[model samples]
Target: MIVIQAKLIFLNQQDKQIVLDLMRRWSSCMKFAYKRLLEGYDRKTLKRDLQGTFDLNSRYVDDAIMKARGVLESSRQLDNNPKKVIFGGRDLFGKLQKRHINGKEYQKLKTKWQERRKGNLYSRGDKSKKGNLNTRIEVKENGTFLRINVGERKYVYARIEAGYKKNKRREELLQEIAESNIPYSVELKLKNGNIYAYFAIEEEYPEIKITKEKGVIGIDINAHPGNISWTEVDEKGNLISYGNIPMPELASGSKDKKEYFRWQYAHEIVKIAKEKGKAIVIEKLDIKEKGKRGDFSGRKSRRIRHSFSYKSLLSKIKTLAKREGIEVIEVNPSYTSIIGMLKYAPQYMITKDVAAAYVIARRGLGLQEKIPDNYIKFLNALTVDELEELREHVKKTVRNKHIKKKHLREINKAMEFLQSLESKPGRVLEPLDGTSFSAYDFWRVLKVAVVTPLSPEKVKRDFSVLKELLIQGKWGGP
Candidate 1:
């Protein structure tokens, strides 16, 4: 989809007033529909009620309901209270409530707030209606004009003042909309007392050039360290390239600036993928806001929630990939980090984040990771009593230190896994086959033996020494 923006110039004051009145009614209907939707009203009933109350046509009412539902859904996704949503600019609303400003400055703020709250109109496209019914653009030799249907036999024409000649893509799309029977949606907003139209048109997506059959570049996004790590792997799951994009400065910028940086980083990543001629494989993550109000959250949690936005960066990357005709594959994010930290990090002598990216790349190629024989030997060497003793030692260490509760739980889970392995016959346990002993089991045992006993700060930063411990079957640290 591509959006073309144009300024609308009205011929007379009467026509402008008519457009403003229509926008006011549309905003009212939208607010009503949103309130009713929150109160559990169905679409059919809301549509009927909106038309009756606002005296709008069926199409206008439907669009209003659609807009309202979109806003409600966005709020729900962000885990915000729908009742507390302020339709107008919330900052302006707060400023007015404080009553700090006076005279023209205060009046200007109030006017801007009112315009934002009530000066909007939306009309969906219909190919049957020659692109749009309520608001349609008509091309003429004189210039391009937007014909708005206000009521029964009522019409208003506004001239489009955009430089279509300067933009080849916009000019082509406009010509197509005028000549062909293509559908395009339009949204009009009153900004600073001028009408602006945003035209949304569907465009054909380019054919995918880079495909995963040859290779894939897997990405791992980290918020704590504020960096993105990626590993390129061939079809056989061998690493071809690896790198990291660090954006520590992104933590201290305005929202718009942060978004701009994200776009820049996304462009850089897609450029690399194009150069490598590989599809992009990213973890399908549903990252949520981490810090809670009035909770004793640490600096990492605060940084993750406030500074870095995983979804925003991921969205930018995916959007750029689509536009560039790059194939994108999403894999389950479960255990990618853990698998990387335990197996690939030490074995490949790489950072945990890069190891995770390597694991992601291999997983994207449908390859299964096998537990190292030394890790299995280390687990098999421990008896039930010895495993219980290790668990107790971890518990005591936790008491003396500040180990997270989740780590403690992981240690307990590993102890159970070891006890279950003891129940099997010596023959079945001798090889510790992949089918019987999974990667998850190995991860748990590593947590109990290596990760738990090591300093938390050291484990988070470096994993080079882990290779020696796992190879020598070292059960615990000094």
Candidate 2:
């Protein structure tokens, strides 16, 4: 969907007052509906009550309920308390309660808070109603104007001045809305003592032109180094090119600035795909809030978690690709990094992140990776006693460090994989005739025997150092 913002020009004071009154009533009904929804009130009963309790019509009441429910559901998704949600903003409310300012500053803040709390009105689209029922935009010979139905045959009109120069997409959408009766939603909002109208219309994406038939470009977003590493792989799963886009500014910037940078980087990525005539492949990541307060995650860990905007960047890339007619493929992220570290990083002579991107690209093309022969040999050479010794050494190492509980649990699982190897060394060391050890077993044992001995800093940054140990069987420092 595309949203167009237009400034509302009131022709007369009467029309402005009517709109203001409607907005105030709409916001009140919205707050009331939110409370009812929290109390387990269903939509049918809540809509009836809202219409009777406020001066809004049935349609407006329904819209109010939808808006309230949207806010409630969003808060719940973020694991926030519904009762503690401030309508305007928690920061402004806190300032007012604390009386942090006086005179003009305080009054200015108070007015802004009131506008945010009580100046929202919305109407859903209706194809039969000419885009919207209560709020409709009409195109006449003179100019474009918005017609608002204010109950009892009363109406208020405002001139719409959408800047076509700044947003070409909005201009095209506006032209479409004027030419055809395409369903479009409108939201009237008051910002900085001025009323603005936001129009949301469905966007028809073009057919995909670039696909994975040629190759795929895989992207890996790294938080510590603050860069996006991407690798282009041919159809035969050979690396054609690789590059990195540094985004150090994303970690510390205004929200708008950060969003602008994300869009810019997304455009860059899509441009590369278009040039190469290949589809983009990215990891399907579902990152939840982590490193909560008092979790023993240090300042650095917290910073990395907070600074990572993988979802935001990936979303922007997908949205832009859709508009540009570029096919985007999402692959499972499981073991991509580990597989890269142990296998591709050493073989390809590339950084771990780039190797991970290569793995993702190959996976997108239906390519399956097998354990390298050297890695298989390295694993098979370990005897049962050596496996037991490595497990004990890893346990002691973890016990000596300040590892998080989750990391400790992961180490314990890796140890279990080691114990399994010790218990049935014959089976695990058997020839790869369909009954040998799986790739997962090798990765887990490697984590315990090989990766666990390295320093935490080295493990996080680079894995190319493991090339010596894997190729020459050189035992590195513990």
Candidate 3:
């Protein structure tokens, strides 16, 4: 759908403050009016009542309504829905003359309302409108105009600029986005900077996917992204290799909290998947297990398990999935990660060459059907392009997750620390949680099956010689 987002900037702080104060007062008056006047309470009649109540001179309430309507129509959601009315916070005091305003002289002592931060509340008996409440005003779809009277004069800063037509300016910009095109609920992010508005579009469907299965699909959710492992059985109920995908959190750190984009991201993906006829598979976490994420395991629980919002997100995803008649399976996660898809199967069960190739090849690719034997030769002969691209994608993805930019450097440094003990045949290394790694345990793990034996005495004797160079403060860096 055609979504229009606008950012309003007050020319100066004083003007901004003035506009903000006025909006607070007007918002209260507005709520009071609506609570009293809106009985039939439906949008069509509400817009008419609000527009007629406000004074208009040099006024253009109609313009704002028209702009919003224009967007709704292009989105094709305006049918039977009333248009929206939003009041952009205003500024413009020092720049104005009495004539420019409604000819009202500046009062000797005037009070204004301001916004409340934290947990402050706006009450009726306050000295000013109190800036205590910030309210969003809405009118049902008709793509109508909005008005605010400045002594009977109204101005429109944000309004519909274009509508879609065969030759319309906005038609090319829309690019097949419409309410009908998106058949389920999802969020669309249209942004400039600083200001973002969220619109919820929900379409109810009877089923999640067109697949023939009626049984549950098991999922294994993870710290970075979620993973699903479900056994697909044949008509005879024979087990099929489970399927899994790493579902990463879509929001980036540099984004402001107020932006709140991931709900929309998750919503959109589920919506599209449903439309494409795929059952949604997700993990059900035990409350206590999910709560203590930091205790998951040795390497992962300590280092990579801290991203929040996954628990809540899974709930929302499942709710939407159920609405679409999709089956969601929650399987016991024991032995899931360490023994996953045959391709990514760990070194103990699968040989090293096979495991390395699988991790490198399928890190970014999704679950897939088996490749023919000849395809392996084709992949082996393919230039180093594949590995390089895979690293680039992983680096970019991880960077956006807000992990410290120096993380890889630190990890490499730690690896070097462990490597030093390679000469110390029986030594082990173990980094504490948050530390790169400990020296004692990890070094021991590496001390095995050496084609050529190394001297343990070399490490005990020479390791102290390199300690200073090995560390960057308490953290290690190569």
The model with the greatest lDDT is 1
Q: What is candidate 3's lDDT per residue for 1-478, written digit by digit as tens?
A: 3343323333345543443444443444344333433233444454555555543211122232333344444445535322232222123233232354333333311111122111111111111321111211112122211111233333322222234343332321211122123321111111221212222233345654533253323233344333322333332332333444434433344221211333343455456446545444454455445233455643433323355445545655565566566655443333223223222332123322222223322221223323223322332232333324433444655533433333333334434544553434543222444544442323222221110012211111122222232221121222
Error of 2 at 90 (Å): 39
Model 2, 43-86: lDDT tens digits are 99988877878988998999999999999999999999999899
Candidate 1 segments exceeding 4 Å error = 1-196, 287-307, 395-404, 427-439, 456-458, 469-478
For candidate 1, the 10 contiguous residues with the lowest summed lDDT are 427-436
In lDDT terms, how accurate is model 2? 0.77
Cα lDDT of all candidates, in order? 0.79, 0.77, 0.32
TM-score of each: 0.57, 0.56, 0.32
Error of 2 at 121 (Å): 15
Error of 1 at 258 (Å): 1.4
Clash counts per candidate, in order, are 0, 0, 32
Q: Please give the TM-score that candidate 1 achieves against the real structure.
A: 0.57
For model 1, residues 431-472, the per-residue Cα lDDT tens digits are 355445565666767656666566532356568778876566
Let me know the TM-score candidate 3 reaches against the reference structure: 0.32
Best by TM-score: 1
